[model samples]
Target: MRTATSIDVVDHDRRRLLRGALAITVAGAAGLLPAYPGVAAGGDAIRPFRVNVPEEDLAELRRRVLATRWPDRETVNDQSQGIPLAKIKPLIAYWGTGYDWRKAEAKLNALPQFMTEIDGVDIHFIHVRSKHPDALPVIITHGWPGSVFENLKVIGPLTDPTAHGGHAEDAFDVIIPSMPGYGFSGKPTDTGWGPDRIARAWAELMKRLGYTRYVAQGGDWGSPVSSAMARLAPAGLLGIHINLPAIVPPEIAAVLAVGGPAPAGLSEKERATFDAFIAAAKMGNRTYAAMMGSRPQTIGYAITDSPAGLAAWMLGHPGFTHWTYDSSDPEKSPDEVLDDVTLYWLTNSAVSSARLYWEYDGGRSPAFAAGEKTAEISLPVAITVFPGESYRAPETWARRAYRNLMYFHEVDKGGHFAAWEQPELFSTELRAAFKPLRAAK
Candidate 1:
């Protein structure tokens, strides 16, 4: 969910190549490929949805990948420059030749997917109702560079706990929705689809689905959405859980914002966390966020055109920096990584997804503002700190942020994409985190 900065140097030749390749593909495919309706015409109806990309589109994607004008290797040996070409080349090569979009598409189609109009945009979600009679409903949100695919691994574990090392009482009815302008969700044509609005739409979506009560969960951008839901205190909403708790205190945030040293009163752990943030900032790891938050459309053009470019662009995410890209690790597998990149490529959501950063208003948005702003959220709040997250949020900051902190625990594993990286552990944390709320439900 955390984005690293874009490539610092703009290769005008690469840009020209990307545009030319895309234009050719679009022109050639026009009037030849059959158009399939992604969302229903107009209605609040929750219409069934399926994945059916035209063969021509896949062919075009391959062509673009093969035609990609890759940039020279980074001047430096390490990732300090950007995603090393050596690391991404083979992956892009495999993506064009061996990677199967159909397999990823099939994985999505296997789920019970649907779309419904929420506010003006059609929201796509995978709704899996647990067989357990007393199952608690929880809506999980995915962050940038992620889709419902990131949560796919945790669905079975959460919704069918009895089959996945948990008791039936721990079962949940899971709702994984694509944020507006991400994945299968319809992109907003106008502004105002920020987290606060998206939070309201989620509440409406949950209500429309007949869930009088539900809990919300999110990480990355989802963190803010879940926070907004908590702040709204919408009727029938039980409580909320977040992996990326916005617990940075305003004083600390202000100091960090100005590149100042940690204040004197910090504990060892808090000081370490503060130092991590400062280090990340110093390394230009946050420049991607700054670019997306300010000029998404400017960078969107390059990613939207070249599939290889898009793949490389997404790989720049800080979440993947420490990930071991092996087939054995389902969470960090190359195929899974490609699945996420291809979704953005196929959906042309690069720009739309980036806009969420722009709308974030540098974390000043009411829903996004953390630390002191969290005091406004009186509802019960639970948090699980993954060891590999951008920074381990100290319990002190969490308590200071949430007025009614109900649960806080740190896991031994997992990173930014917690559920995707460790679905079993992630599900266990959720079951435990929401157990108290289930009683209230």
Candidate 2:
């Protein structure tokens, strides 16, 4: 029953007009009917928003973190029993003593953030327009255990490419949205807010912003949402790029599903991928997924109340649990991870966000859902396979899935959180991936 506090004051005149325009545009889009209660009576408003969490909330979060009951250290050594107390201790210590939520708030407030009602929920997003004229518009979606915070680092590089070792033509108007029930976005009251639904909402969002042609990108849950957008192929959606492209073939899927061995006719890389996937699955690290997908509400009580509990669950979740997949050096520090966890705690979105798993591919590992009912995408598609991903998608599988595959690359490092972990490489990939599609402008 936790509700987000709204700003008391708003620019009545401007927000009213903007909502009117959005309402008019979406009236005809059958799939994007808005049912959310907070929309201005006159229209489907895209209101300008700012992040200003109250002082008491911050104080309460620290109190909870410090007041956490300690759990005994794991019996076995190593991560064999999941993230040991050894890992949790440092994270909790930093969260309680060293972490600063205000700085994170200030960084978020510096960005141009907004909220707009789409398909019965208020969607929060960060929109940064590139200064370069004719900059391609791109919508970047973040996944579970992540928010728009995950994509923050890449904003400067993607929107202002010139300053980040890229030509002006490489710039993009970046849009990072907080999925419904995550971050400042409103939680859904009913079912059906899955990737497909979110994709339609993104299309409506871009149209509201007057983007005639744009590209989409994401990793983790973002991959499925971006893929859904491509399949919808609205008038302006030109292409999509995803790091965790779920491109497993039916044969591989069947083998994995039945706990069977790799099929006889596979190449060396394919066989290796199958083996690695099977091995990763056997580790039994997906207990979080099972809980969230089946009973988000049950777990919500614990995470909503205990900041430490939330951090532990997120830190050890199957979706990119480690600080970084790169073995040499960590791509993200413990502090960065705390910021993300704190945001979730403050918003009380752990349960609501976890509910998204139930909506689509419930309790199933992202790799296990091969031949799922996916919309056929005819638009140009681009994919990047990072070294540290759960399972690298083979080029053969990607080519087979996407009809108009324009670009595909395998980078040296980075895992599930590519944009957050390696903004430079991520920005470079975006520049190259959509280079061909930009000509459509």
Model 1 worst lDDT run, 10 consecutive residues: 1-10
Candidate 1 lDDT tens digits, 1-441: 212223212222222222322122335544532232322334756666667776777888899988889788889988898899889888888888999988998898787777688887779899888989989999999998888999999999998998999999999999999999888787776778787899999998888787887999999888889988999888889999999888888888888878977899899988998898889888888778888889999999988878887887788888889866678877788899999998888777888889988887843422123532687999999999999888888999888888799999998989999999999999999999999887784
lDDT of 1 at 358: 87
- List candidate 1 stretches off by more than 4 Å: 1-42, 362-372
How many clashes in candidate 2?
0
RMSD of each: 8.0, 7.1
Residue 373, candidate 1: Cα error in Å is: 2.0
What is the C-alpha lDDT profile of model 2 across 32-93, one tens digit per residue? 33233334445467666666666667777788788889888999986768788877787787
lDDT score for residue 31 of model 1: 51
- Distance from true location, Cα of 440 in model 2, Å: 1.5
